[model samples]
Target: MSFEIRIARQFGERTIAAEFASKGGLTALFGPSGAGKTSVLNMVAGLLRPDTGLIAVRGTVLFDASARIDVPARQRRAGYVFQDGRLFPHMRVRDNLVYGWKLAAPVDRWMDLDEAIHFLGIGHLLDRWPRTLSGGEAQRVAIGRALLSAPRFLLMDEPLASLDRARREDIMEVIERLRDELKLPILYVSHDRDEVERLATTIVPIG
Candidate 1:
């Protein structure tokens, strides 16, 4: 997978202009807070619209102001994993994972139930509720949920920010395994240098 983004957006007193392309692998948007890293990710995910510019993945134009083309977020096929797991408190782990999978188009469905469960190492917790899981476990389930959707790419916004040091390391290892095993291009956003150095194959500095 490849990404080419050249977009600009304004937020009150501040304006963010980002232009870059990635050939594949894990690309980390690295910078301090308020550097617009999350903003860029949001635009890429189609949650935020750019005032002007183009966003294309592999040659499919997701957005293009000049051509008046803008694909909706749900159709973009980009899986987003926020810092918080955001799992449904009312649903079991298995139900949460299958929620998006059920809605995914047949053509987009590549992962099966067992595959996603084993991939994130959450098979044993499938029957448990979200509240019963620890921070790291919740994040893993979150990642599994995104993967089950069979997304074209993954967008992670400081997924480790909410975890403790040990939990951070735990999730980091899982992310690294995902990068190597799944071969899915990931656009990871973070300000931590160590995390970037360890997980990112390419670093795009923001701000």
Candidate 2:
């Protein structure tokens, strides 16, 4: 098991919660829009802390409210890919990919800069800026940036939501490769039933 999550947070009158243990591979949070799927992903990524409960990944306890444990976001080593590829507007593709890589310590780093570029097939786009890349290309670069960080697990929130049908399929194949070839643990959040069915090994409903 790569994930053990049972957390909840209050937002005024609404309370967002999630409870599930991943059975390896890619686990998805499936639900309708506005059901707090992204919030749960944020909690896992340490961008948002749950008011109460535990969040453990790969046997490492990230947050345990009962124990008064809340690991810092950088220490969590969670790779997060947002719906839109949030690349640095000022940086070229190469710089963007290496930003996280440089932040990770040598021992913590698993993938090298060249390996990530080759894996993502973005070697040719190194000189290009973020605005110059296409949607699918930008997404691939985003994944590469996250992967180069050498995270223990990945949290993807609607990674394919902004793409067209053809581009979605392209990115889906890339994700499948990450799951099958790299064997990286992923917590994916999506509202599309078909996308969840195609990408997730275990489907945990949200809302």
Candidate 3:
């Protein structure tokens, strides 16, 4: 599926505007902090209602202000990964990964849980809680969880922001593999120029 976004909104006193079409591949949102990179992503994910615009994914109208069509966030069918790996502290890795599927209404179950587990190299951490895993492990598990949701598009906001250089590189490789193997379109947010060059098929340079 593809994505097209044309939205305008206000952030504090400044107007943030963006218009772009994204084919199925990784699109990097590259810019300085506070450039409204995440804001644009939020609109596409139906997390933020735009003041005026339209958001379409594979020709499906997720938001169309003129038509008064606004699909709620949960129904957007887009997966999101935050900067901090927001895995449940007490839940085991396996439990956290399957949580998405459980919450999904009419879950597809199209993603093979076993395959996702192995792909992220988290098979060994399945029995462990989030706290026991390293930062890299947590992010990997988070990615796996998002994939298992059967999302049409994945939004990753600084997925490597808090990690050290080595850990960041490790996760980046995993992301590269996932993008190619799963054939998933990813909207990846990053301030690092190197990471953008390494992973992005198209760059949305903010600011």
Candidate 4:
């Protein structure tokens, strides 16, 4: 899916206006901390309302101030992955991965549970708790959960920020594989230049 965002919002006294568009593949939102990167993603995900702008994915109107259209967050067909991996501590890996699939309402369910387990190479870790898994493993499960939702667009915000060098590398490799293998459109938020170089086919430099 393609994306186009033209938004303006007030951040205290400063007026922040973000404008960009990407066709497909992985697009990196590159900028310093607190540069409205996450805000853009949130707007696209229908989590935040823009002051006056247009946000669309594959010609689908997500937010249009002119038309007074604002889709709810849950209604947007976008999968969001946070830095924290936000797995349910009380749930097992299997349960955590299937949570999105079991949510209210329904659409196309692309990623199968067993297929995802094999895709992320986490079959052996399904029975383990989040605490027992390493940082990379936890992130993989998080991504898997997002994929199982069958999102048309993926919004990932610094997903590998918490991992160590080795763990980050491991997860990055998996991300690369997902990009090429799945051929899914992604709006990846990150500050790491190397990660951008390795994964992004397009770049949106937020400032």
Candidate 5:
């Protein structure tokens, strides 16, 4: 099992929390708009500090409030693919992809540049600007960037939310390949029932 999460954060009078121990493979956080599903992902990725509880991936501890342990975000090595595919606008595709790869040591980088481009099918977009790429293309580039980062785990926050059905299907196929072949533990956030049913091996409800 890769994910073992039991976390809660306070937002004034409101408290957001999620508790689940995955059996491995892809895990989805299923819930509504204000459910704080993304918050849980943030906590796991070391982006947001939880007021209490533990967040562990595989056997490594990323956060444990009781133990006074909190791994920095960069050290967590989480490949986060946001809904908008937030690629750097000023940089070309090639530069954006190498950003994280360069930060990682040669040994820590699990995949080389050519390999990630080939896997994500973004070979052609290497020179294109983010503005020129379609929605699907941008998302593909985002995934490629994540892969090149050599992440131990993945956090996808509504990856298909902004795409049309056709484009969504395209990204879905790519995600399926990642889920099956990469074998990395993925924490996916989505409000769509169909998306969750199709991609997640384990479902954790949040609200």
Candidate 6:
């Protein structure tokens, strides 16, 4: 599926403007810290409203300021994986993965529990708690959780930033597998050039 975004937003002293469209595969928003990568992602996720622009996925209009159409975040069906795993501390790994799955409409559900667990290699951690997972493992579970929600597309914001070199590599491999195997469109926000080079199919430079 294709994803299109052309939006602009202002944050007091800074005005962030971005415009780009990407087809299937990983699209990386590459830029420095002050650049607006995360801001653009936020707008796409329906967390922020743009001053004026349009966002669409597979020709489905998500946001159109001219038409005053802004889809709510929950209804957007866009799965978001933050830098932090954001798993429920009290739940087991399986519970965390299925949390979104349970909320998703049956018609929107794409991946099943077994498929998600296999895709992210989290089968072994199913019974474990979030607190026991390493950075890489937690991120893997987070990805699986998002996938189970049957998102139209995935939004990842610096998912590997908090990891060490080894952990980063470990997670990178999982990301690569997701890109190659799942063929799910991904909008990845990151400032690291090396990571972008290795993971992105289309590079949308920001800033």
- Candidate 4 regions with alpha-carbon error over 4 angstroms: 104-107
Off by over 4 Å in 3: 105-107
Task: Tell me the whole-model lDDT of each prediction, alpha carbons only.
Answer: 0.91, 0.93, 0.87, 0.87, 0.93, 0.90
Question: Between 2 and 4, whose lDDT is larger?
Answer: 2
RMSD in Å for model 4: 1.5
Per-residue C-alpha lDDT of model 3 across residues 98-199, encoded as one tens digit per residue: 888877756555686898887887888889989988888899999888888778888999999989999988998898987898887888899999999999
**Candidate 1 residue pairs in clash (backbone atoms < 3 Å):** none
Which has the higher TM-score value, candidate number 1 or candidate number 5?
Answer: 5
lDDT, candidate 3, equals 0.87
**Tens-place lDDT digits, model 1, residues 1-207:** 488889999999999988889888899999999999999999999999999999998778999999999999999989889888899999999999998899898888989889988777788999999999998899999998998888999999999998999989888998998799888889999999999999999898999
lDDT of 1: 0.91
Prediction 6 global C-alpha lDDT:
0.90
Q: Residue 72 CA error for candidate 2 (Å)?
A: 1.1
**What's the lDDT of the predicted structure labeled candidate 5?**
0.93
Candidate 6, residue 136: Cα displacement in angstroms equals: 0.8
Task: Report the lDDT of model 6 for residue 169.
Answer: 90
In the range 101-184, model 4's lDDT, one tens digit per residue, is 777346588778889998888899888898888888899999988988778879999999999999998888888887888888
**Candidate 6 Cα errors over 4 Å, as ranges:** none
For model 4 the local lDDT of residue 171 reads 87
Q: What is the lDDT of residue 7 in candidate 6?
A: 92
TM-score for candidate 2: 0.98
Better of 3 and 5 by TM-score: 5
TM-score of each: 0.96, 0.98, 0.94, 0.94, 0.98, 0.95
Q: Which ten residues in a row are the worst by lDDT in model 5?
A: 116-125
Candidate 4 vs. true structure, TM-score: 0.94
- Report the lDDT of model 4 for residue 124: 90
Weakest 10 consecutive residues, lDDT, candidate 3? 103-112
